[model samples]
Target: MNKLSKLALSIGSVPAWAFTTGIVLAAESVKVNPPKYSVVSVGALLSGLVSAAIIIAAILAFVYLVWGGLNWLTSGGDKTKTEEAQKRITSAIIGLAIVAASWALIQLIANVFGLNFQEGITIPEIQTNK
Candidate 1:
């Protein structure tokens, strides 16, 4: 296969590798402490994933903004290039604003529900008779 196809194949396999690794690690943990996996753990996992996604997106937005600034500086009186850079910067700013608004909305909902996003998830214990 060509280089582009090879690269695509490698990238496509990454999620499969991650999924397999996660399953293996989870199974090992279950073998060590079966009680650790519960509703609270799942909630905590979801929360962590969401936080990570937000952080990654914010970082990407900042990087795009910087890239646009660089492009603008390097345009050197070219109208088309300058306009493209301006568009990039504007889009990045808009994306950042949307992200901020979403974060605020999440915080507001969490507050209304009396939930702390920073805190670990709380799940009531269930009593089982052997």
Candidate 2:
């Protein structure tokens, strides 16, 4: 499609918040109950979300670090530019380390809180005579 048509189509599409609100408000008096937790279970998707957050943060941090290193290598010993790049690399490492540590901390907290995200318990089966 032409650029103008693409722009028009994009603009014509309903904005997410407005569309969500329209649907939400249209549903009058609909109720949703909060999820319940059992003594042995945690909410589904919590662990997956935690791991996804760590992975995303690590990838972003690594990208920034590589960009910074390239900038530093190209600085030709210019003090200001080199120092700024060094700072960027340092901050990226710190950020990635913090993200990694946060993942560990979350697991520790989960264990302490006795939460398990597995949906079901497993049991071994016994062999039967043919």
Candidate 1 wrong stretches, greater than 4 Å: 1-40, 123-130
Model 1 — TM-score against the truth? Answer: 0.65
**C-alpha local distance difference test of each model:** 0.82, 0.76
Q: Tens digit of lDDT per residue, candidate 2, span 1-33?
A: 999999988887857546664333455686876
Q: What tens-digit string does per-residue lDDT give for candidate 1 at 34-113?
A: 56544347667766776777888888999999999999999999999999999999999998988888889988988897
TM-score of each: 0.65, 0.54
Error of 1 at 3 (Å): 48
| Native-to-model Cα distance after best TM-score fit, residue 71 in candidate 2, in Å | 1.0
**What is residue 125's positional error in candidate 1, in angstroms?**
6.9
